[model samples]
Target: MAATVFAAQGASVAAVSTTVPAVKEHLGLSATATTVLIVAVALSAGAGSFAGSAAIRRSGPVAAMRGAVLTSAIALLLIGWAPEQATVTAGYLLFGLALGGIDVSANTRATAVEHHYGRSIFASFYAAWSAGGVTAALLTAGTARLGWPPAATLTAQAALVLLLALTLRAHPLPAAPPDPATATGTPPIDLGRGLWIRLAPFGVVLLVAYVVDSTVSAWSTVYLHQTLAAALSAAPLAYAAYQVGTVTGRSCADHLVRRAGPAAVIRIATLLTAAALAGMAAAPGWPYAVLAAGCVGLGVSALAPLCLASAGRLRPGAAEAVLARLNVFNYLGVITGGAASGILGSAGHFRLAYAVPSALVLVLLLTARSFAPAQGVGGGVARTSPDW
Candidate 1:
């Protein structure tokens, strides 16, 4: 149920995210201005992580989800109908706040549900998010093709979430306490304050994944429209392609993880993505560009979740704190990477912008080993060859 609501929220925002190119034209925004807008959204979203977590703790997940969804609806309406630059910018921030809350609350609930079931079902939750994103991208394409006003389109998307919310159960699910058993059989490595050092690789990997993700989500449409001369209706297919890969990759990630340890799977996947991104940057036309987008989606699918899984169990009782800090890393990557790509695109270097993150995939390749099972909180587990 929670995952379903999260999916609706994901779809609503994805519509805005993938259609930025169209939005820019709608408001006559400069590339620099669009960059600023995206950066603001990413920054505020990071803050929402902490704020949303607090909300969940106090009011419960259902309340937090409801509040966040409605908040996003209001923000979306403002964005769709705002008369000027400042109004739309304000709307982006408000949307960011709501997105942050939704992200945390949904993930927290998913984890709890997974724990209750005593198995690994968390991947399905993320697959749903990607599915929503894909749906939104497709919807945006269809809506644009039909010559719908961006304002009406966005308002309808917002309404979808609000209406979906009405059907949800009134109360939140029971909070599943954090699993006491260590995630990795290995004993915990208490770095004390130095735990940051141990967590650096996880952070680095997540940063790169998000950087690439932001680049794609925020710029794919722009690239297709401006660089390839794609029709506005077809441009969002680039983002849709990316999300399709994301859904398929995540849905099947556990199989790969189980077949080949995470290290091998992630490293190989990064390599494929890096190559795919390079291909995307040099795409000759929209069809090729969309194909490249799919490659990228599959390539980056497992990175953020794998890293976060490792980050969460780094410490015995500090899981929340550690996870919170990692969330900050996630947004930081988006802000830095998304801003850089947006600015570069603004400057007529969209190809270079796409190419850069492709290069960063190597950095993730180097850090792939970081996804190894975490140190035990008390005693180390048996160090099996494939355990990592």
Candidate 2:
């Protein structure tokens, strides 16, 4: 439900951002002013992310998620009613703060759930998120057909969020008692450990996979419309295809992991991801783009869950902490991928942005032989391969 709210509001905001030129005309503002407004929104989102990390560390996930929902709803209300530039900017900042808080808190919750379940479920959870995004994208497109004003559309989204929040309260998982062996809180197993060494290649593979996913989600619509000369109405279909593929891929990931093991799965997925990116870069039309996007989604789908599951298997007692540390790198991928995409697009080489991550995946494939096999629960670290 929280994901749905975020997806709906995010899609609405994206639509508004895309129609900035028309909005400027309607509001009697220059193109420069509109560009500044959008930049302000992006900056506020960054600040919110920084602030939210601290908030999650201090307040716990349930409080943080609730705060994010309430704050976002209020911000949307302000955006709907405020006429002054200063007020609008402040609302955008608040909206960013809410998004940041939600992002951190939700992931933290997911990590906790995975630890408690004692199995791989992260990819399926993310698939649920993609389902939310798909719903939001469709709703936003429908609203566009109705000729709804941006503010009104956003306000309606806020109402829906509030309703969802009321219907579904935040439920954080209970923290388990710490085991003394791993309870020292000293960062579990240093980077030099054999297990860490063996896991490094798999980690690198997941990192590059995340970067590829982020790049596609952030830029595929624009790439479809601007670079491929697709109709604006059809651009979002690329994302829809990707989301569908992710959902489908995740549904079978656990079985695949059980049947083939993480090592074999990662190797095949990495190669497929490289091929998918190459296809996207060379796509000649919308149909090809959609097919390529689906391939990309399927190829990248199991990477994250496999990494998290591997981390859990590596140090069952310290799985949460290990996963958390790896998440820091995952976030770095998101940041760098977005910046790289922007730079490449500005230089008229947007395709390189996708291709570069493909190369990174290939590098991960070369290093794949080094990953340790999936050790069943209760198995000691001694039995794990030293290649990680």
Candidate 3:
């Protein structure tokens, strides 16, 4: 059920990416304006993470998760139905808030489930998210073929995704007891000592990883068309290849992490990311570019899931509070990645944009060891059985 919530979120995100060109055309938005809108959405999402922490403390994780999904549904409707840029931008902010809330709430819930089940399953949950994205991309293509308006298509997808989220409310876990930090008159998350250094690296890694994603998603089509001279009809292949690679890598990520641990998984994945980016930056043609995108997708796939799983297990406060803090990095990544790519793309530096993120990943390599475990899941939160 927690995974389903995340899957629904992924589908909505994929749907939006699928329709970006259409949305831009419809609203008469420049590339810069659209990217700025994304930045705004990301900022709101960061703020929403804090708000979600408070919501979790008051209403329990279950309610907060449900609310976040429902909120996203409404935001989608607004974005789909809106006639002007301002209205659509406002809708994105609302959607961002929902995304932030869901990120903290669902992951916190999933961390508990993973620990209870023993071994590793968090990466599998993220695999479901990638699969959901692929499914949505397929849906978007079908809708486009049927001559459905982007607005109608997005609205319909939102409704279906929301219904799916609604049905999964309590299957895997019941409502969490309200986090006591709200009532204890204390800071929600413990930012003490080693926890800060441990968490600080995640922010940098997540930001760099997300910028890579943003650069590709926002500009792959343009890069293929303008730089590689691919026909417009075939430009989307780069994005599609990336999604497929992500699904492929993530499908086995949990097993790999379980066998090797998070630090090793992340280190190997980071190297692959750097190698892929170098290939992408120097690709001679469309086919090479497309293939490199798959590598990027596959290598970058492990970071988010691993960082999140490790963060949730790091204890000093409730997982909800800890996750809420970690989730802000996602928005920072989204905002900066999208905004940077948008700027570079506007200046006609499409080929160079992917390189920036690649170079940033090398810097991230320095922090790879931060993902190492200092301790197991904090005591008293939940019990685990190896038999599972």
Better of 1 and 3 by TM-score: 1
lDDT of 1 by residue, 1-388 (tens): 7667667676876877866876788999998899999999988998888898677656666677778888888888888898889999999999888888887666655544443443344556677778888888888888899998889778777776677666666532233235432122333334478778878998898888888998999888998899899999999998999989989998987667656767887898799889999999899898999999999999898887677656655653334346656788789988988899988988899999889889988887788776763222123232221100
- Of 1 and 2, the candidate ranking higher by lDDT: 1
Q: Residue 89 in candidate 1 has what lDDT? A: 95
Candidate 3's displacement at residue 38, Å, is 1.2
Error of 2 at 210 (Å): 3.0
Clash counts for all predictions: 8, 4, 0
Off by over 4 Å in 3: 172-194, 225-236, 283-288, 373-388
Minimal lDDT window, size 10, model 3 = 175-184
C-alpha TM-scores of all predictions: 0.88, 0.72, 0.87
Cα TM-score of candidate 1: 0.88
Per-prediction RMSD in angstroms?
Answer: 5.6, 6.7, 3.7
User: Candidates ranked by lDDT, best first?
Assistant: 1, 3, 2
Clashes of 2: 4
Sort by TM-score, best first: 1, 3, 2
Better of 1 and 2 by TM-score: 1
